[model samples]
Target: MNRTNLCIRMLQLLKARGKMNTTQLADALEVNPRNIREFKKELVLAGYNVEEVKGRYGGYILNDQYDLPVTIFSDEEKDALVQSYKFMRTQKDFKPLTLYCDAMDKIIATSKISSNASLHYMSNSIELDKKISSMIDKTQQAMNHGICVVLSYQSLKDETPIEFEVEPYEIIHYHKSYYLIGFSLLRKDYRMYRFSSERMFKCDISTRHFIHDNHFHLSNYIGEHSLIPLDLKHVIVRVYHKENGLRLFKEKYWGNKLLPIHKEDDYTDFEFYTDDMSNLYQSLFSMMDQVKLLSPDDVRETYLNRVEKIINAYKG
Candidate 1:
């Protein structure tokens, strides 16, 4: 038989039997074992994840998720379906589209759709950073299968890399950065790890499944803290609304722990939370005449003392 016909037969047989070693496939197709291995390579290049098993039950099998029921769609029907998918692909929220593509990939693969056709119709709208995309893909797979992932995390300050064994809850993209929000086994708490600063090298799907709290929400967790945790401290600052400074603060820096603005004539009290006080102080100091510390006696006095020192140093 021709190579194309033999591959089609091999796929059909694997789908029926769930798996087949090279010897079995070669015998069934009346071909050399090397031919079977070559066919597996071709399947992989065509976007099918053909996984290899080792030891006594060694064989090549399609990924369990892709062992889909047979599908029959005419060329015209597929064209129409892809057109509709293209329209939905243009929508903003990507999860739904991602899900559709995953299922469609299986359906089309089972139906023997050409790779070029699949690529043309199902192109992604969003472009992810290639350096991080592989890690993101692995983490996502772990999330779907309820597996534990080990990541090598490098912080901005730390020279050495740290290992994190986490149960990934979600991958969030915020402000041109990606974050993996997961339950850290080491820290024994829910934490958000920066994906770009981390490398995911291994994933182990334990037979032990996790009991997920239905009430656990990513937004609620992030709402309680800033995007990056420095040294958290509650702060209250008074700002004179000179040239709409309050509006600018609201537009740019407004987030968690920002208490309602208390307006008194020309000044407004801006109560918020911050982890990095040095950065916050520098920002406030630059606005010297327009902003003032409202409370937290020590922080207020510190700002005042710094201003005094700057004034003294520049004495005429």
Candidate 2:
């Protein structure tokens, strides 16, 4: 779209294919010869040398020694990367990207920003776990190459490890966890595998490949920050004050599916749907006295019992 993006895409094309002619680059990038020249100029201006060859089946090539720095980051991309880093730091199973995390802050400062709001300094010293990182690499390779993956997943409830082959469609980051969404041959259906908690003991790219379902839409399968369908149960919470649960529901990061039922000057009734009652209960429990549960007697009872246990623990 923009000059920088076009140049970057061209660089990516050249990097992938080693070299390409004017026609090949034009056809691959879906741009004209003039546009390819313009993209090359932009890349050259950005400190990348684009060599042109003048022969049959010769076009342009990126030099092997030149490395591309991550220079162009929009506000949205910066926010996404920051959030991912924050999530990565929270996972004890893997070491945090401490240097990269610090570098992100420096990049944000150097980059132009329209807002004057204070940024959250989430500096932490943790390193990524090698075993888990290896799984991630294998999973990414499977997704990129359209190949099946063999994984040994260990669930907390299960003693023995479960090994299966799956066709990875997408990798999702929900809350503070990473999940691989794919069609599982073991389950004979589409499912999501959470990498942080479920724990992948072994992951290998298989020679077997699969045709990605073009009709599959990730947003339709999982909500913006939710991994599963929210159609199973409806949860209602009444907020007596605006600064309480109301404020949290209004924030974009809290998920946008919270429906306001009754809106008044001082009080508001909000409805949230989720299949996982345990998760809903945990979220509501964090709010403490700010909210009241209205429906689903079992959920309410569970919340109350948990609260009682907490209170008794403090008292004891």
Candidate 3:
């Protein structure tokens, strides 16, 4: 009901109906003549191209066409979407914001879910830490300001659990777990610690705050690096087929980088790189005849050694 909003809404009315006079605009907006005149000038300044007549029957009109779309979101629904994805039930993914937006289009289109609408599912599809999600959300804000995190943690080497101060660098979700990537004061190095395993977590004053990078976004961190053990190298295996698989790759990976390297009706090579070759190794064993380790000799040997161990076990 704000006068400014009403004035803006008047354009939508005029776009629907051919034109509207200053009197009608005033009546619609429930404002005075001076207000309507001011609104008209404001609209003109906003590139509305307004025209007006001076006579008694004279009225204001739009000199140009309006093509912009008018869209609205219900307050409750917007709140729900924000709540669902903001934290706890957060939709924070390893995908970049740009990539996330692209994925959101696909997610909304395929899932038939509204972008700003609340998510309510009959069947549970997501599993994670609710409290930890909230904490992580806070951690992101704190990371921007170079704050420290004090969380209850248990180490495998230690018999009892302890709370320690650590600088929150990033949060990476992988293999059904949420890990906080950061430099620990006690450990004095970059460490990946589990959030769910923590009994309690909060910021401590004794610890130092350090902003790692403006582009030190956690989503990209997860997408680029996550779920792999230390000292593992990423080996991208590209597979090319004559047809069909490129579309599948685009659909699955949702990127042009992998798809452009392969073409339709041409031999398409499938390429993916991984240091933790356990999954790839097993896959290689199954596709022994079709799949080839096109990259490093060591990568191929790692697969061979696993097969050798299996053969040795079978013989023994």
Candidate 4:
């Protein structure tokens, strides 16, 4: 069979069933196993990554997202864009979070979401998984049809093969990640699940109608730590030593919002803040010694108290 027919048939098969390995695909395509290998090379040549799974549960997965370049700008251009966005989000007076989202939507509407968005934010950390290409396509179709969808989520709260019958509402692509915002049947509340790290996905339409009178906006339902809420302004952090805690600070942030104030007495100060104390603490604790809260007594006290507990816990 021609590769075109083969791909079409395979797409249908995958839509019906979540995933299929090399052997299954080769057999279904009615070609020699060796030909299957050649076909995959051809697919890659045509801009697709035929992913190979290793170990017991490993199999051949089609990565359609990587099939082609979907953006007008090059890699450097996109990185600069993300950096600028990070600054806008974390700035002291970044108003109209929705505008940011809207602007991003417009900027990325026609472009490829894969290359532009960074699903994993872990800097230099060996932690990331390439999301299945078919999953997002199926999700888009499901969302368009207003059907129930399933998710295999492992983040923040739910961490299992969650069979969620959800009414798909919106697709949020922020912080170099894509999320599906919807109403969950199990929780009976709104939740946003990341498209990445999704082990598997399947969707079906239900005859039942969703109660959509008092719609809880996605912007409000998001966590406080997010730049959307925009409560706390900015803070000025003064470092003691010039090269002190620099690594920790950079590792914590992407070097967008935290700007250098000055270097003093072998110490330097950077300015950045957020309403989410936990995020703030994470950013601060990474700067083991050189980091200090120059202003905002409350934030300083919280850090000191945590330090006290640590000290008491490890008393000599």
Candidate 5:
């Protein structure tokens, strides 16, 4: 290892093992015992808290409070990190956007000397409106501080905005949109609100502080295949162009409960247990003639009706 890497490894060893004598550190780092003192000086000069112990069991110890910034990265790891940053950049209204960019800039600056690889990434994430972005920021701040917020929200069913107090718990991203999960003071229960800039007229952070409910867990409300708390259904579909359909499902619904129940030479019968039927319908519609809803008679009827409406519209 180079001198720079050796110094870093020594600090890491000290941090992990608590304390290490010169000989022990040298053995661990595969360096000479004499170089240990030099490495300690280098770390101290770089603002790391490396302390020396004088007793028989003593050696060098990194202060427990101070954490060393991880600067080491392989070429592949650096490329992957850069690509992640690029992808995040595509989400123009991502909360904590500035913090992520600043952190990535620091990492890139440190890794520039080791590798100079260029990478590109593309994403189709929706760009959030400015008002919605501001609301998300406010909600995040409230969640961090354990505070209440007054939200003027208007759901699709509500003709006018309904002002209510909420104990903000968590904000989650799903399907290129943001949702707030919190305790609604009006309903006196947990609720999930999909953010809409046009409908959400006000999101004012209140002065009242709140203690987070210890019994409340996100998993209790949201299932593995759900965007919000809802009952999941067993759905089966027959998809033509087996190769293409399989690839699409694997790419889009990799984590969901998807399995192949049957297959033919040209088509495949895929089963999915999902709570997000809207997303499912949208994805199936995108596949056009290559997909068919086979089971759950009501859902199949709904899909057929939607297809018929589209067909009729086209005929007009």
Candidate 6:
């Protein structure tokens, strides 16, 4: 890490973990023991009250009463913050817009980068519905307070609306949709439910509270679920330059998994991996004339059948 980040991290360690000896701080920051003393000096210079205690058991601690100084940001970091503020400004349902704008202005003022120069990029993310926004706020509050919520959910597979209690663990945003990942009392297992007004009729936070499982890691849980799987299916495709296949690869249309296996004058064989075959097939179909599925007979047959059905529909 850079000197600025290192100093900030040292202060964070002291504030979060309380008193720590130089050796402990050095080990945590992966720096020399002498460097911890230097970091403490830098923090003190930056208007932080870092006090050292005397004795064998004593160590350095931050004065909890003192307020933190305005954090200085690098030019690149300032640009990123400016761009994020611009993106959030476009979100109609963002409730804390005023506070965020004020905070961004103050942060940018302290940096060398001009906020006006960084306004070149705008996000095309879908705006959240007002109902969904309200749902997210309530769910966040319930999760913060460790309370259970009664959700009236209408599953697509079933028309009847079912009421169930869920212990909200995390709210996930994927593919322009919000999902609540929680423990379902009805199923007695973890479940992921979409947060849409069409699907979720109601969500009421109950007075009942439950102890949050400290061992529940969101990444570990998502890995076990199919929403974000760890196992990826390998895919191979022969791409011709005729239909902008090479341009798609250049633009990283296949995400981070696109790789070249073999190259020829007229065509190239590329390999990639994905957990979502449906999305992959859609992408391939969009460029069907320029790409051919070479391996994985089952997947190839499925793709061919879907194409055939589409052709038959057009013929009819």
C-alpha TM-scores of all predictions: 0.40, 0.48, 0.37, 0.41, 0.55, 0.57
Report the number of the highest-TM-score candidate. 6
Residue pairs in collision within model 1: none
Error of 1 at 214 (Å): 4.6
Give candidate 1 misplaced runs (Cα > 4 Å).
Answer: 1-128, 155-159, 185-189, 198-220, 228-236, 241-288, 298-316
lDDT of 4 by residue, 242-298 (tens): 463665556665223668888766667777656566567776777667677776776
| Candidate 1 global lDDT | 0.65
Q: Once model 5 is optimally superposed onto the true structure by TM-score, how far is the C-alpha of residue 151 displaced, in angstroms? A: 1.1
Query: Any residue pairs clashing in model 2, and if so which?
Result: 21-59, 95-127, 95-128, 96-126, 96-127
lDDT of 6: 0.72
Candidate 4 residue pairs in backbone clash: 47-67, 118-176, 240-267, 241-266, 241-267, 242-266, 242-267
lDDT of 2 by residue, 1-316 (tens): 7666778889999998887888888887777877987777667667785766433455688864512343677678766765554454333324434544445444533453211122222233234477766776788877767689998887677797899999887665555556687888787677778776357777899887664443344444553234565555667778767555567645422223678889788878888766665567676777767778887787788888988998999996
Q: For all the candidates, what are their Cα RMSDs to the real structure?
A: 13.9, 15.0, 18.1, 16.5, 16.4, 14.5
lDDT of 3 by residue, 1-316 (tens): 8767876787776776755677787777777866876776678668675555433455666546333333354666555543444232222333355554444333333342333232222223456566766776666666555578776777677666777887776555555556677767677656777766353444333345442322222332332222434334535454444245334444443111332334345545544444345555655565444444555677778777777888999997
User: What lDDT does model 4 reach?
Assistant: 0.57
Compare candidates 5 and 6 on TM-score and give the better one. Answer: 6
Those runs of model 6 whose alpha carbons end farther than 4 Å from true positions after fitting are: 1-125, 223-226, 255-257, 312-316
Q: Better model by TM-score, 1 or 2?
A: 2
TM-score of 4: 0.41
Candidate 2 has its poorest 10 consecutive residues by lDDT at 113-122
Name model 4 segments beyond 4 Å from true: 1-132, 152-162, 174-177, 196-218, 222-230, 233-236, 244-272, 275-286, 294-316
Identify the superior model by lDDT, candidate 4 or candidate 6: 6
Best of the two (3, 4) by lDDT: 4
